[model samples]
Target: MKKIISWAIIIYVLYCIGMAWYLFSFADSSIPAEWKGTTADPATFLTPREQVLSEQYSQWKNFLFFVSVPYDWLAYLAVLWLGVAKALQTWSEKATKSFVVQAAFYVFWLSIIMSVLTLPFDFISYRISRAYGVSTQSVFSWMRDETTDFLVNTVMLFLLVVVLYGLIRRFEKRWWLYAWMVSVPFTIFFMFIQPVVIDPLYNNFYPLKDKVLEAKILALAEKADIPSDHVFEVNMSEKTNALNAYVTGIGSHARIVLWDTTLQRLQEKEVLFIMAHEMGHYVMKHVYWGVASYIVLTFAGLFVAGRVMNWLIRRWGEYFHLHKISALASLPLFLLVISVLNFSVSPVVNMVSRYEEHAADEYAIKLTKDADAAISSFQKLTKEGLNQVNPPIIVKIFRYTHPSILERIVFLERIKRGD
Candidate 1:
């Protein structure tokens, strides 16, 4: 078991190094020739005030993001090494009757502690956003949202842990496969219910009230063969000054959602471009594809986690006061493996996401024949969201789920030129 884990760790480390090599070796620096006479630098297109704000916002988020990676690793490690998980398991065993109920209690306790540990980072992020004029949410309102989020996450985590541990106990060898099978339907159920059952808890949503705008958006949706019945507007301005729109949910619950801030801030043409892009998401079945990709990754991740977990239990189980891989006390170790696996595969996952975004951009341009609108909309989003146009290559590859604004703009110009 020690030998197997050693090999796995070596291979995983090598894969990450290879990805880093590829990322750095091919770091992009080119911009379109047309950009030379105009604003060559994406930030220059913003107002002087906006440029300063964009840099500050981008730097703060990037620093927080990178810092949190190591912080999360240490937090999970602390819970395991400090016997926090063991303590929770002991308490749950004494406090509960049903094994499943005990699992729930353990999950709740661990989740609450982890949330508290991460609150300082979250609070700092909120304050930074507020300072930069992005977040409009008050600290009290943010805390309320965080509390609601915590409860929802705890319930979901409790259910997942109970099911996973049950599988580990019963199947022993093939539990990873069973867990992956269960996740498919579980994920679908959440996607179907989120818009109706969960989202409204955080913010208000209603059918878009603008008849003229609704008519235009519905026309675009029809062209993409997406549902044209209703476009939902979320009251996001109360929480954020950032402008955006997206497609969410699945099947009957599937709907287009516009941040109210987007409508208030962007032009009608820009809004149409944004709507078209989101409709492209539905038409292209990006959500289903995303889910499929996630399931595949989760299958591999769980398999690796199971393998590494067994080795770890054999190697240091007694030292950590962990009895078995299936024991509730092993939850922290399970999380640590999963986190490492997730971080290792993030660049690949993010590449797929960026591809989807680029495809959607193309679809929007092709459908609207409004390349000008699309380009301007990208610029508007860059300024409004305070996005970095050309963030550091390492940061872009690891952290960005969508292509940088500069990349999108250059791509758009190429498409416009038929290049």
Candidate 2:
């Protein structure tokens, strides 16, 4: 039994190492050649607009240096892992209950510690938004929002981990099915609570103010055959400089949340264009596809984690101070798995999202007949949000969800020229 367990542990460790190496190698190899130019390159092909966005990225990078406090806090979880391992090694074989209790306690303790670490970045991000005149939330308001987020996330995390651990132990071979079943309820719970419970905690929402705009939007919905009531505006300007719009919720509760900043900053035609874009996501069923993809990826991650954990527990369980099951120790491994999956498959995800966005852009043009407005809207939003105007192809593949501003502008230009 001991030999079998030892070999399982060895094989699992090697698998993890190999997986990590493959991910890193792919990322390195995939970096686009265009982004390799030095910061000092004067002859760079960056347009004046691109130069300005790049400068903002530089400033944000500097601000990020002060944000290392959170990373340090996350590191403490590893330290806790070591401590738990020591404790488990010293425990008697007969004390299984005590071992499990200790392991659970450590998981909870690390979770609390990581949450505290995350607070600084959360506060800093909000502060920067406020400083930039993008957000209107006061420190007190920010704290309230953070507390609510923490509570919601904590509940979700606990439920997910508890169910996941049980699935791994009881139905190791059928863990994927168990996980998919769990996600059904989880998805329903999120859908029910997000609009009602979660979103209202951060921003104010009111029925769309302009009757003409509301009618136009509703008319467009009718044309698209999407059953939705009045369009809604979210006071998103109170939170960040970022400009975004989305269609969320289902049935009667379903409504579009247009950011106040987007409305104020963009022309009426431009705003409609943005709405058309969001509607395209719904029309194309991109959201459903995304959710399905996540379900499959999550199951894959759990299967890998189970195999790895079983091997680790059998061989080094005693040596590492892990008695029953240590969710905390397994977390880093789980994250690594998810990260690799996301990075490797990012191009496919981006391509799908970009396709939906393009469809929306086309829809907007069709409705408004203002391709010029669409182009200007893209430029203004990108500038205001400090988005890269001309990121390299490599960056687009790995990082960007939507196509670059230049690409969109060119596409619209072609549409205009054809007319």
Best-performing candidate as measured by TM-score: 1
lDDT of 2 by residue, 352-410 (tens): 77877777777767867888778778867766775555554555675567877767876
Per-residue lDDT of model 1, residues 100-174, tens digit only: 889988999999899988889999999999998889999899999999999998998888898999999999999
CA lDDT of each candidate?
A: 0.83, 0.62
Cα TM-score per model: 0.90, 0.74
Q: Candidate 2 lDDT (Cα, whole model)? A: 0.62
Name model 2 segments beyond 4 Å from true: 1-54, 58-81, 84-108, 127-136, 228-230, 311-320, 323-336
Per-residue error for 332 in candidate 1, Å, reads: 1.3
Clashes of each: 0, 3
Clashing residue pairs, candidate 2? 85-320, 85-321, 277-360
Which stretches of model 1 miss by more than 4 angstroms?
Answer: 1-34, 37-40
